[model samples]
Target: MEIFNNITIVSSEILQEFEKLSSSVVSDAMDILNLEHGGCLPHTIRPLHNYTKTLVGPITTVYAPEGTSLPVHLAMATHVQNRVLVIATDNYKSCAFLGDIQAHLAALNGCKGIVLDGFVRDKDGSQGLDLPIYCTGTYPKRPGKADLGGINIPITIGNIEIQSGDILIADTDGIVIIPQAYASTILETAKKKDASDAERLKRVKEFNYNFASNIHDFTSILTKDVAEYIKKHM
Candidate 1:
């Protein structure tokens, strides 16, 4: 039942700071560093509710088999406080990997949120809980608690290798994983980007400035007589 090995838990200070950032801003920062993948989950996984608020925390990863819920129970029992629980169900898409009861337990344990690469059910029940749950979709069928999969180990979701201690940012835009190794650097860049974006928005609102028009090359390309040139050459 103890699967919390080789997993690093980020400090509360770092997690608190990251909680302020949106996934879009964090993703923009990741793009700047040429980290193309940047731990972004697939669009298929979405918020269970219309929760517009962002969920940020270190990840407590769970790897479970399809049609089973034992791993989740183990994960909940061993999960650290203020961390996001990430579940990978071997790309399974049939049964609901989690439900309201599990959500309640996670919330009780101070978990920030839940992200599954599988599915979840109990939409109405989950809505009442304080935790935000994200998954590929929902299914009426429930999982049996028989199989015990890995916990706090490296698991792949949306082609991203999510490990324990990695920061997960989820909002309306979707989920993004910030690798523990680059979390500090990424957070610093993301904070700066957020500030810059805010300033840009203010300037645009105040002056209605078309910043894109300042790119002369782009403007020239747009206005280029490419059709005429192609006809003449042909």
Candidate 2:
């Protein structure tokens, strides 16, 4: 079941480290590095379930055509333990590419979750499984086995180039793809940002401020007045 022969596996320690960080924190770190477009996947993509827990894992990319399930099935058959399956459809919105059955198989194969840049069916079943699934939306129409796609290859979802081994951090905010090359550095920076954010939040709570001036740049006139009031009180 080794589909990607050249897959680069990230260590468990790194994955665990990323698990503690939120997508927003990682995105902020990426922005600080001037890699503005690195952390977000697409605005259309969203989590299927209401769970707010974050998903962090290396990705196994799958490029599938519209109304096809062969490539997805093949991806499920591969070594996917603790890995996130990223399915990039060719911007097809007609039929569902993945559903509960496939999600069950993915879970059995040790997949952490799935990010579909398309649609899926069996919403109830998928929700029952309690697996972390992020996608554009859901469709009632099922997919066909056309076998017209590739696995473990570079795919584009929302103009973001996703490759096998790239780390995916997804939560309620959205999905963030941290390229393998920049993962270590980004994680380090994100940790620092998370710490600073925690401290700032504590101060905000203590001072009962609507927003932290140091953390946020307020531009709106009303917000500016509020900031001034808070400053005067402090």
Candidate 3:
């Protein structure tokens, strides 16, 4: 099946550029673009392992039932190089749908990371593989494996529905998704703003700048009326 739907494939070169960006920068870009919720998945869907590096990639998704992770295996069989494997487990809490085995396979498949709406197990072993696994949490038991699930289809993570090929960026702060249709625009906007954001951080570190000065006018991200209202209030 064609995994992409009228989406321009992001090259590894571009992915490298994105890797240098934090989820916060991308989230800020999404906020400026006014993508609802800024494409954030949810606060609950988080990293399973502590990672110093940011996870960046287009996602290949698996919609798994509460107990079965069969679709993940099938999806992993395909090309996942430099990709993030996202599994929607329907918010099942009874058990972990991912563990060391899946993490190992994903690493072998050249996947850059994993994101699940459900729990995972084998934390020690999975951590040993050095693959970034983002999930709701960890559960020791998963009961249903024979049940069927879909692969490479739209799946809901938190309240947001994520298309299979959406760009995913995660870090210590949180996770954010860039929809395929808006991918290029958001990426460009984020890349451009990233330079200024770095400069802003530098000023903060060097001079204890609180952005109390309105020189950059960070309120530009708001609607004209809202920005005007804030300006008047401030």
Best by TM-score: 2
| TM-score of candidate 2 on Cα atoms, chains taken together | 0.85
Angstrom error of the Cα, residue 145, model 2: value is 2.0
Give a tens-digit lDDT track for model 1, residues 1-234.
337666576877877788899898888889887774456898998988888678888888888875788988877877747778888887797798878888888899888888887888888888867788988888989888875777888788877888788889898998899988898888899999899877766654565345454443233233235535544553
Per-candidate TM equals 0.83, 0.85, 0.82
Which scores greater on lDDT, model 2 or model 3?
2
lDDT of 1 at 89: 88
- Residue 58, candidate 2: alpha-carbon lDDT: 91
The residue-by-residue lDDT of candidate 2 on 1-234, one tens digit each, is 124556787988888999999999999898878874456888799888887678988988888876687888887888567788898887688898887888898888788889988998888887756469888888988888885778888888887888899999988888899988888889999999899888766654566346536533432222445768756764
Candidate closer to the true structure by lDDT (higher is better), 1 or 3: 1
Off by over 4 Å in 3: 1-8, 36-38, 205-231
Inter-residue clash pairs, candidate 1 = none
- Give the higher-TM-score candidate: 1 or 2: 2
- Candidates' C-alpha lDDT: 0.80, 0.82, 0.77
- Give per-residue lDDT, candidate 3, residue 209: 42
Candidate 3, residues 10-121, lDDT tens digits: the string is 6676677778888888888988898863378778988887788888888887888757877777677674666788888888888888778878988988888888888888
